[model samples]
Target chain A: MYSFTKPKKKQFFKEDTKLWLVFYAISVFLYVSFALFLLVKAYFYSKNNQIYNQNIITLNTKISSLTLQKENIKLQKTIYEDIMVKNSLIKDSIKNLLDLIPDPITLNKFLLKKDSLIIYGITPTKDVYNLLMLPPLESIFTKTDTTFYQMPNGWYKFKSINKLKGNNETAFN
Target chain B: MKLPSIKIKLPKLKIYGIDVIKNALFFAFYISMTLFIIAFIIAPSVKIFKNAKNSYFLSKQEFDNTKQNYRHILEQLTKLQNQNQQILNAFKRNFNENNFKLFAKDYMNIIKITKQKTIPYKNQFAKTSYIITAQIKSPKNFYDFINNIKNYKNIIRVYFPIDFEKSNKEINLTFKIETYRLLTAKAEEKAH
Candidate 1:
């Protein structure tokens, strides 16, 4: 008891106490609201993650499928170009063979097979066919056989067969 | 042993209608509530946020990588098709005898083109063989015809059993040609 102060009753909830209570309420509200905000953000993040995962799987599958298709097209192109090259080689080979014929010995009828060539033509003499046509045929083929028949006009009709052994050489291209 | 006791008096505040004694209890209640919420709700919420963030980052990385891979494959496929445009078109082209004859009219005279049979090739293509017999003035026509096959609409291949017989003045050429083309489907949609 103070001599100069008036007698007063003590109040449990003073102005300062109420103010402190309000502060505490505000602090708790802020803490709880922040937690709730974090929870909502977490939920959205999880949802977005799930969507991204699905997209990733779909994209990977598509990528793999496209890769396979690319390989297939490459294979097709390889085969197609290979055929074209082979066709060109065959053409060149036939052209070279036709250009091998000499003028003096006429190639009346010729048979060009896959592995062999049969030439039937007329020559003034057997010696002319042997000297002009037989040497080149022997050079190009693995084997050559020529049969000459004496014609009524004193000329010779010759049949020559040239074959490629094992069909391994590029002779027929 | 017995210890001597000392009496000590602590001041107590007295109020009329306010229970000042219970203030300590309320203060403790506020502190306890705060602790409880922090332990039960806020902690778990923070944990959920952290876990979800981590998962999202991982998935995002994977998604980005997959997207890049898809783009790369698509680019490669388009480039491959563009590089082999002629080959692709030739594979898909159908064989037309009349059109081919007209195209070959400059090279040689096509006597006949009889389609022999159809067979499967490479599991995705069909190969049809044809017996072609024609007359040419010289072997140069045959050479030009074969050379021009590369530029033809359909892919053609010359097979074996090719014969060249001299007929009177003109030369007779008999040969087999195979045309290769795509099967039915499975390459159109994804390629585009």
Candidate 2:
């Protein structure tokens, strides 16, 4: 009679264990390197984020200040321009009103200093002289004290001072 | 001579529970590591790319919006200044009270075919413009009033065919008229 038993597989897989260990080491190394890369990236990203936030804050402040400055400059420019325009308008109005004053006055030796105007000339006729000395006409031309000196040959020189007021509202023919 | 031999046999070994558990744990660890690579590393990089693209687009949009508004404000300011200048120039010619009175009287005389009614005068814009409201006796009076306004010097526009009430004496017609005066030459030139 012969005895019988089940047979076992040989240790052929043990020879490939080193290969599996190398594969496991490679996988672990790859995983660790990737993790480090991510860590570095995250650190840089966070640092950049902080810098960006700071920059945004600073830029926002600058923008606000710049906007305020621009508005102030605009307002100042408008105010200065308005003042210039008003001054020019007043000067032109004075010139035009003065022109409306009778041409017969024949402004000669005219000197304007401060608030006074000194005029020296001779009136062509006595009648024209009297008209200039009248109340309403005289009042328009001379809003202040006036002095006149009569010389030879029916000639007279006058010195007058006028206080400027609201531009001439009188109608001129 | 003859020789006889017997065949050899070996016993089977049973697998241990510790060895099975060890294999299962190794498999689980490898699967978890693979999942981590895909989830933590690959996904975040993709998200960063998308965000960068979006931020660039938004920045350009903001710049364009601000630039357009700046131009519009400048245009409005210029237009206002021009209109002001035009008004100043028109006043330089003559818009005195006497001229207004003369022009009004002439207009009334031309439309004498229709009955006229007195209107209260209203002044505006530092007395530069005057408004008057009156009533006409008939529709024909309204027509004549319009024509007269067109010929008037200081009178600019007239509102006629206004709401009215029917009366025994005449048809009550209410209308408004406007008159403008030019600024003095000195004021006009200065404004320019």
Candidate 3:
């Protein structure tokens, strides 16, 4: 049922049409691939951002607490230094009080309290204690009383009680 | 390999000795398709991609700065702790009565140490005291004891009601020794 012509293969599409379609498909593929790559990169970046934000919050909390701890250390140092200074003052007061005793009086015992001091001593005469020891005690204490007992020997035994009222005790001094 | 050759037959009719109408229609189609693809797909995608890149860089820089700040704070904290290491350690130590007696052995003879009531001090510390009766040869011993306390292992405050009584040749020294310890809620929990 054919004429005397060479038989040709069936053509589904023209050559130029196929070429144009391939070009368009490549362009679309390249665009889609690039867009997808960018989206994946953006997703990763956002994830990293969230992680870093969380880390920042935790670090900030730690930093604040560390600062508080530093302040606390400073407070401890202040307390320590104050206590040391108070201790030195106590020592100085005790030294000064001990140095107050004169040669005429022989101290038997002395009770040093926060607000009061009581001294028991032997004096060569009542006048010796009254002249030397009584004046200093009277100067330091708010109230002072002296009781005398004559010893077997003419030497007098005197008990002096010194009292400090209110907060004017001047501490141990 | 030999490729198959294909062809499409077009209308033979022409005007003005050329296929100007068909060529113009083809050119118009290509131009419109190019403009449509660029505007609707590629341009929008590119813009979004650029914005994402910018955001990523911004977040990265912010993270770097925050990390630097954290490191700086950490370093400062370490330095402070190191500088006050002795005082901080002393606050944490518990007062040992036997150790204290041994420490005071050089200064005086400790006859007795009676424990007193414990009280809270400064909200974060516990103050416990002992009424101590000791014997010393002279006032110099008491002076030395007070001075050397600065080098002791525990933090202590010598309080009031100190008495010095001369009994025979020896002097009886009675005083209150206050020892402070860190008693924070965290430390209390650790104790339990």
Candidate achieving the largest DockQ: 1
Off by over 4 Å in 2: A1-20, A40-98, A113-121, A124-143, A152-156, A165-173, B1-22, B31-192
lDDT for model 2: 0.46
Write down the TM-score for model 1: 0.76
TM-score of each: 0.76, 0.34, 0.74
Worst 10 residues of 1 chain B by lDDT: B183-192
Report DockQ per prediction, comma-separated. 0.52, 0.02, 0.40
How are the candidates ranked when ordered by TM-score, highest leading? 1, 3, 2
> What local distance difference test score does each model get?
0.85, 0.46, 0.82
Can you tell me the CAPRI class of model 1? Answer: medium
Model 1 lDDT tens row, B46-156 = 999999999999999989988887888899999999998988888887899999899888977899999999999988898999999888888888888888888898899
Give interface RMSD, every candidate, in order.
2.6, 17.7, 3.1
Q: Which candidate achieves the best TM-score against the true structure? A: 1
Q: After superposition, how far is residue B106 of candidate 3 from its true place, in Å?
A: 0.5
Give lDDT tens digits, candidate 1, residues A1-173: 45887868888877747876897889789988989999999999999999999998888789878988898899888898899888987887777766777777777777666788888888998877778778889998899998989999999998998898885654665
Identify the superior model by TM-score, candidate 1 or candidate 3: 1
Error of 1 at B170 (Å): 1.4
Off by over 4 Å in 1: A1-22, A109-114, A122-150, A153-173, B1-44, B185-192
Better of 2 and 3 by TM-score: 3
- Alpha-carbon error at B66 in model 3, in Å? 3.6
lDDT of 3 by residue, B26-133 (tens): 568767877887788767877876776677677677778877877887788788789878888888888888999999999999999999988999999998989999
